[model samples]
Each structure stands twice: as C-alpha cells, then as structure tokens.
Target: MAGRILIVDDVATNRIVLKVKLMAACYEVLQASGGADAIASARIDQPDLILLDQMMPDMDGIAVCKKLKEDPETARIPVIIITADNDNTSKINALRAGADECMSKPLDELCLLARVRSLLRARDMSEELRLRDSTARELGFAETPASFTPSATIAMIAATPVTAMAWKTALGNTLHDKVVVIKKEQALSLTKTQNIPDVFVIACNLAKPDEGLRLMSELRSRPETRYSAVVMVIPKDANNKSATALDLGASDLMIEGFEPQEMALRIKTQIRRKIQADRLRETVRDGLRMAVIDPLTGLYNRRYAMPHLARIADHAKTSGRTYAVMVLDIDRFKAINDTHGHTIGDIVLQEVATRIKDNLRSVDMVARIGGEEFLVVMPDTHLDEARMAAERLCHVIDDRPVILAGDKGNIAVSLSIGVAMGGLHVDVRDVGQLLESADKALYCAKSDGRNQVTFSRTAA
Candidate 1:
C-alpha cells in the first residue's frame, strides 16, 4: 500500500464512499463512526493521515482536531476536515484548530486525490525525520529546544502590480508577518544575502495562463527557496489546474479569490510546518556529525577513520599508486598527565594534534584512534615521501613548547611515529595487517629512543 488513511464520519455511507476512493488509489483505509472512536483508532493504529467529517452527533471536527493536536501520540498525523458549509468561517475555524486542510462537500475527485497525495508525501517526510530523531536520542544526542520563535515573511507574486498590492493589503489586515509584493522576475533573482521569505503566495495566471506553475517549479529547483512553502491562487474559471498545482509542490491553494481570514490561517500553518522541518533537518545533521567526531580534539574518531583508510587503500590499488600509513603516539603522555595534571595534559594533546594537522596535506587522513595515539593515511605517496612527512611532524612538535593557562609556565612535547607502505609493489591488502605492521614499527621507535620515526620492514 502507498499509505494508510483513516476515514471518520458519523454516517456509514460516507465512510464507505471515502474508503472506496482511497482504496482505489492503493491506500489502506480505516473507518470510525464518530469523533471519539476516530481518536481511539488514531492512537492505536497510528495511520498516516485522517479524513474527518465536520459535523458529527457526538463532537465537531474542530473539537476533534484540537483534541488530537493536544495529544502527543497523534499530534503529527495530518488531518483534513470535510465540511458541508462553504463559508470562510468554517475554513478559518478548522485551520485554527490545527487541521491541515478544510475541504467543502461535493468534493472535486481529482483535486481531492491530489491533496491526499500531497499530504501523504509530507507526512512520510515527517515520519522519517522523527525516526532519525528517535535514534539520535537513543544514542544520547538530544536536540536542544528552540528558545524563541522567529517572525515569518511572505512574498506575494501576481500577474500585475495592482493584483500583488491588493493581496498584500488583504493579508496585512489579518497577518502581522512581513509581506512583500514582487514580480516574477524579481522572485526568481533572489540572492543568498537577501531576506528569503518563509512562504510564497503566487497567482496561477502570472503574465500568462499557468505561468505560475513554472515559477513554482523554478523555486522548488533552487537551493535557497526549495524549502519555502508555496500557496497557489487559482481563478474561478481555472479549477482544472488545482491538481497540477498540488502535484507541482504547492503547499496549499486559495480558490476563486482570497478570503483574508482563511488565507492568513493557511499561511500560518505553512510557516509552522516549514520551521518544524528545518529544525528536524538541522538536528539530523548535528547527530551525524557528533557520531564521527572526537569532542575534545575535534578530529575524526576511530569509527570514521577505519573505513576511510580502507577506501584510500582501495583507490590506491585501482590507480596502481603507493600509499602510506603512520601511527603516532605522544611520548610519555601518562607521565605528563601525572606530572602536570590531566588538564594540562589535554592541552598538550590538543597542541600536538593541531601541529600534525597543519603540517599535512588536505588529502591526507588523520584521526584520534586512542587517548594518546593518532592514525594518518597518505595516498599516492612513496616510502621516501612518507619518511619526510613523518620527520617533519616530529621536528614540528619538539620545536615548540605549549604554553599553560594562568601563571603556569610552558611544557615541552614530542611524538614517536611508525610508518608502513602499501599498494602497488606491496603485497598487503588487509587494513588490519597494515595497522599491525605500523604498530610493530611504533614499538621499535619507542624501544630505540622516544621522539623519533621508525619504518616497518614487513610492508616497506
């Protein structure tokens, strides 16, 4: 099934009719006879969306929507309220109660199906974000709560300046958000530095018939404006374009003309949703970053470095070039911690990491593999180049003294490096074997004298 939809109506015929339509579209349909039963089914079944009847003997659609929004379990599911009343009041009330859409009775079948597809698509995206967030929380990386709400901006684009200004005035009476009137050309030419609106209200007949659809597509394709919500305003004679508008990524639509209250409500809903999606995306990015980065040193962790080194080895094999791996350890790191305290020891480790990073090329990989040890992989490098780079790292560390905080003085630091070569002339293909060879070389460096470089005889 494409998705699961719950139909809630007091009448059996209403439920059957809606179920048949949804099932024809490859959707699994569930039914409820009243508002109370609908809420129960929603909490238990966790359907992707709900299609609700406005007037029921037990409770109204607006009340049901408010109840659902108040509950955490069913709050995120999208709800569309079907009402027999065609007045603007009903639409505004339903929207204020947190209904995603309000449709009048004698529904247009094509437009209804298009709206269903759009809502289901949005719900699926939200579900995926929630799933990732759940995983992040389980990994002990919870997202920080937002401190404040930012004011939203809306851009109004119409066929003529007069129409644009009229829309601005109508929306201004009800909305406190910043609304700007712009031409089609200006809308498409927005820059990154300029203020980007949170929502766009576009007329379908801008300069020509169905020209706004093309504009919407352009906005969707652009990186800066792709996430902004768009509401297409269709004329009374152009009802056939409603499905096209929704399919082309319109968040909502205003038919015939604008009703100030209804338009304001719809715009607010779009802004709320956009903000939520943006926050979820940011949390997911932060979680992924935290998973592979060392918090103290800000270097790649062991989890990220092992796979990365294997990829470099694979590339070297295909290109028929040589690569080098180096295992580095801070000499007498534990004694430094015991003598200067772990706080100063951390400072020394950070300074050493910085020096090693600055001396290496951008293509080289460096990671914190243990408390006092780091791994570096250099591709397309021979034994001589690797020796020179390792020597350079040793000289750079021993040359300077890391300054301590407060009245304390400076402490000297040095590194012992182990080098191993692989690919082309080398027979080693296993990453574990390469690491073991380098580790043996590192032992040789420690045994001979600290603060020096050693090469592995096994691989080189």
Candidate 2:
C-alpha cells in the first residue's frame, strides 16, 4: 500500500465512496462512522491521513479537527474536510480548525488525488525526521527549530507587470511577508542570489501555460530552490495545466479568479509547510553530523570509524583483497599542551590533521578516534603500499613546524604509526582483531622511537 488513509463520515455511502477511490489508488483505507470513532482510530491505527465529512450527526468536522489537533498522538496526521457548503466562511472555519485542506461536495478526482499524494509525501518526510530526532535526543543531541518570522520574502512571477503589481498589492494587504513581483528573465536569477523567496507564486498561462511550468521545473531541478514551496496559478479552464503542475512538483494550485482571501490563506499554508520542512531538514542534518563528525578536528569520530572498519573487513574477506589498518598517535602531544597553552595545542592538532588528510588517497578513511590518536583504513592495499603511505604521512608532520597565531614561533610535531595488514584467512581478519594488532604495533613503534612506523607480525 502507498499509505493508509482513514475516512471519517457518519454516512456509510460517503465512507464507501472515499474508500473505493483511495483503494483504487492502492492506499490502505480505514473507516470511522463519527467523531468519537475517528479519534479512536486515529490514535490506535495511526492513519497517514484523514478525510472527514463537514457535517456529522453529533459532532461536526470542525470540532473533530480541533480535538485531533489537541491530541499529540494524532496532531501530525493531515485532515481534509469535505463539505457541500461553498461559503468562504466555512473554508475559513475549517482551515482555522486545523484542516489541511477543504473541498466541496462535487470533488474533482484529479485535484483530490493530487492533494492526497502531496500531503502523504509531506507527512512521511516529517515522520522520518521526527524518528531521527527521537534517536538524537536519546543520544543527548538536542536540536532546536529554526527561527521563523511573519515577515518573510515571497516572489510572484507573472508575464505582465500590471498583473504582477495587482497581485503584489492584494497579497501585501493580506500577508506580512515582503511580496516582490518579477518576470521570467529574473526568476532564474533569484536562484543565484542570497535573497531567494521563502515561497514562489508562479502564474501559469502568463505568456503560455508551459512558461510557468518550465520555470517550476527549473526551480525544482536547482539545488538552491528545490526545497522551497511553489504554488501555481492556473486559469479556471486549464485543468491540464493544473494536473501537470502537480506532477511537476508544484506544492499547491490556485484557479483563475480566486478570491484574494483564499489566495492569502493558501500562501500562508505553503509558507508554514516550507518552514516546517526547513526545520526538519536542519534537525536531521545536525543529528547525522553529531553521529559521525568530530567537533574539534572536523574529522570522522570513533563512533563512525568502528562501523567503517567493519565494512573494510567485510570487503577484504569477500573480495580476497589485501587491506591495511593503521593506528597513529601524536608524539609527546601532552608535552606540547603542557608547554604551550592549549589554544596553541589546538592549532597544532588542526595542522596535523590537515597534513594527514592531505597525504592520504581519496579512498583511504581517516578518523580521529581519540584526543591524539587517529585510525586509517586503506582498502585493496599491499604491505609495501601501506608502509610507503605511512612514511609519507610521517614525513609530512616532521617536515614543517605548525605556525601559531599571535607571533608564536612554529612548534615541531611528529607521528608514530602502527600498520597491520589483513585479508589472509589465518591472520587477524575482523575489525576488533585488526585494531588490536595495530595497537600493539603502535606501542612497539613508540617504544622503539618517537616518530617511526612499525608493522605487526602476521599469523601463520
């Protein structure tokens, strides 16, 4: 099933109709007869979306939507209110009550399906981010939402200056966002500038229906504007353009001759969604960075290195290819910190990391596993190749002194490397065993001389 959708209506026929339509689209459908049952089903079944009838026997859709929003468990599931009423007041009430969308009795199946797919995509993305956030919280990485303000920047693209100016006036009256009017030639330039719009309103059929569509395509293809929400304005008779816009990644659609109030509401909805998406994206990015990266050295940390070592082990075993694991330690790193201030010590560490990173092949993985220790994994490498690489890295450190800020003279630094080769069935094969071998070699290197490479003895 693509997603699970719950249909809530007191009338059996209404439930059946919606169920059939959704099932035809390969969605798993659930049914609820009234508000009570709807809330119960939403909490227990956790449906991806809910389609609610406006008028019910006991509780109305507006009240039901409020109840759903109040409950934390079901608050995230999107609700679409279906009503026979055409009054703008009804639309306002539904939207205020937390309905994601509102549709009249004679629903356009194309529009309905497009809205459904769009809501499901958004819901899934949010849920995934929420799950990752939960994991991050457990790991003590707390992520906060990005700051948002009512005064956002919105760009409207139209063919004629008159139409664009008119829209700017209407939207400006209703929204706090800074509304800017632009033409096709200037639309692509926004992608290059730092002042990109929070939401893009493209009026299709401005010159031609395809012009706005091509703009939408370009915006979605570009990395800068791909995540920004887009709402397409189409002529009332242009059903084809509406459908194509949705397929081309338009977030919302406005028919020609739409009320200024309704347009304002739609734009507000799109902006809120864009903000939520941006926040979710930032949270997930922060979580991933915390998991893998070392904050001080900007290198992969031990948390990321262990699994990578296992991957190298698995590949070497399966491909019967030789791989090398090296454990490196800075010589007398504590003495450097003890003699010079820790600030200078930090500069030295940063410089050492840069040299180590610069000396390795692109395929090699280097991670800062401890305060002064690093782990390097080289796949498909021979013993001689590993030794040569380690020697070069060692030379890079001892060759030049790290320059410090504040006119401090350069400080000499060196590295002691321990190399262990794997791929033989008889020798240390797994990551744990390989690390043990490398550690012993590292200890031997430190004992023999401060800045030298030592190879581990292979098993029979």
Candidate 3:
C-alpha cells in the first residue's frame, strides 16, 4: 500500500465515493460514518492522513478538527476538510481549527491526489522524526522540545513590485511577523549565510506565466532554503495549478487570489509545523552526537572507533595501501588519580588527548577508548612512518605538564603507545585480530617501560 488514509463522512455515498478514489491510487482506505467515529478510528488506527467531511449530523468538521488537535495521539496526522461551502470564511475557520487543508466540493481529482501525495510525504517525514525522538528519549539523551516559538520572517515575491508590496501591507495588518518584499531574482539568489525567510509567499506567475513555480522548484532544490515553508498564490482567473504546485513541494496553496486573513492563517500554520520539524531534527542530531562522543574529553568513544577503524581498513585494502593502528595508555594513570585526586587526573587526560590530536594529520583518527587509554588509526602510512608518529606523540605528552584548574601546581604525564600495521601485504584481515595484536603490543610497551612506543612482532 502507498499509504493508509481515513475517510470520514456522514453519508454512505460520500464515504464509498472517496474510498474508491483513494483505493484506486493504491491507498489503504478506512471509512467512518460520523465525526465521533472518525476520531475514535483516528486514535486507534493512526492513519497517515484523514479526508474529513465538513458537515456531519453529530459534529461539524471544525469541532472534529479541534478535538483531534487537542489529543496528543491524533494531533500530528494531517487533516483535509472537504466541504460544499466555498466561502473564504469557511476556509479560514477550518484552517483556524487546525485543518491542514480546506477544499470545496466537486474536488478536482488531479489536485486532490497531488495534495494527498504531498501530505502523505510530509507525514512520513514527521513519523521518521518522531521515531528518532522516541529513541533519543529512551536513551535519556534528549528532552521534550520547549513550547516557546520565536517570531518568524515571511518573504513575499510577486511578478511586480506593486503586487508584492500590496501583499506585504495587507499581511502586515494581520500578521505581526516581519514580512519583506523581494523580487523573484533576489529570492532565488539567497545564500545560506543570508537572512532566509521562515516562509515564502510566491505568486504563481512571475515575470512570465508559471515562472513563480520554477522558482519554487529552485528553492526546494537548494539546501539552504529546502526546509522553508513555501506557499504558492494562484490568480483567480488562472487555470488550475494547484496540482503542479503541490507536486513540486509547495507547502500550501491559495487558490483564490490573496485574502489577507486566510493567507495569514495558512502562513502561521506552516510556521508552527516548520518550527516543530526543525526542533525534532536538532534533537535527533544532538542525541546522535551524544551517543558516539566521550562527554569528558570531547573525543570519539570506543563505540564509534571500532567500526570506523574497520572502514579505514577496508578502504586501505581496496586502494592497495597500508594503514597503521596505535593503542596508547597513560603511564600510571591510577597513581596520578590516587595522588592528585581524580579531578587533576581528568585534566591531565584531556590535555593528553589534545596533544595527541594536535600531532596527527587530519586523515588520522583519534579516540578515547577507555580511561586514560586512546586509539589512533592512520591510513596510507608505512610501518616506519607509524613508528615515528607514535614516538612524536609520546614526546609531546611527556614535554608538557598539565595545569590544574585553580592556582594548583602542575603535574607531569606520559603515555605508552603500541603500533600495528594492517591492509595490503599484511596478514591481519580480521579487525578483532588486528585490534588484539595492537593490544598485545601495548602490553609489551607497558611491560618494557612506562613511557615508550613498541611495535607488534607481526608488524613488518
């Protein structure tokens, strides 16, 4: 099935007709006879989108939409209210009640299907974010997003400056948001560092007919503006471009030229949805970063290093190049912790990590694998080069003394490193065995002396 859609109508004929249309498009259709039943089905079935009838004997579409928005379980699902009334007031009321779209009866099939596809695509994106947010919450790495939303900026672009300024003035009377008038060229030329708008209100026809749609496609393709909400305004006499607009990634459509109050409502809805999605994306990124990074030293943890090392080894084998792995440990870290307290020991560890990182090339990977222990993987490096690099790392750490946070004294620290070679004419193919070889060399280095570099016996 392409997606699951719930059809809510009081009349049996209306439900059947809508179900036929949706099922023909390969959608799994669920039907409800009234508003109350629709809400119940929405909560239980969790459809991806809902096609709601405006008038029902038990409850109106506005009341039903409000109820669904109030409930957490059904709030995120997109709802489109299909009504017989074609007045601007009806559309505004439905939008204010939280309907994602309001369409008059005798629906244009092309536009209706396109709208369905668009909303389903958006719903899928939100679902993926919700799943990630759930995972982050389960790991205790993310918190619920705060309710406060910052003021948004909306950019209006029209075929002529007069129309654009007119929109700005009209919207200014209703929307407190900053509305800027810009030419189509300026909108297309916006860069990432520039002040990008939260929402873009575009006229369907720019200098040429349907030129604004071309601009919409351009904005959608650009990384900097792709996430911004786009609303395409169609002229009253213009042919139906709603289907094309929705298919090209428009967030909403104003079919009947510009009505200030309705446009304001739609823009606000788009802004709220965009803010939510942006917050979810940020939270997911933070959670992912927290999972693989050592909070204390700001270095990649063992969980991220192991697979990364394997990738480097694979690349080396394919490119017929040799790579080096070094496992290093602080000399007598426990003694430092016991003598100077763990706080000083932590400072020493951070400084040592910084020194090791500074000495290596960008191609080299350094990670805090354990307490006072680190792993470095250098790709396309010879055995001699690896030995020299390890020795350099040892010297840098031993030469420097870590300063305590307060006016406390300094503490001298040193690290022991074990070097192992892999890939392209080396015997070790398995990552586990290669790591074990380095670990064995590390043991030898520790056994021989506290602060020195040792090479594995198998590393030619």
RMSD of each: 15.7, 13.0, 15.0
Give the poorly placed runs of model 2, Cα more than 4 Å off. Answer: 146-150, 290-460
Model 3 regions lying over 4 Å from their true place = 237-240, 293-460
lDDT of 3 by residue, 240-277 (tens): 58888999999998864657988889999888888998
Please give the lDDT score at residue 186 for candidate 3. Answer: 86
Question: Could you tell me how far off, in angstroms, the CA of residue 220 lies in candidate 1 after the best superposition?
Answer: 0.4
Per-residue lDDT of 41-92 in model 1, one digit per residue for the tens?
9998888899999999999999999999999989988999999998888998
Instruction: Report how far off residue 185 is in candidate 2 (Å).
Output: 2.0
TM-score of 3: 0.64
Tens-digit lDDT track of model 2 for 385-416:
89999999999999998987778778999999
The clash count for each model shown is 0, 0, 0
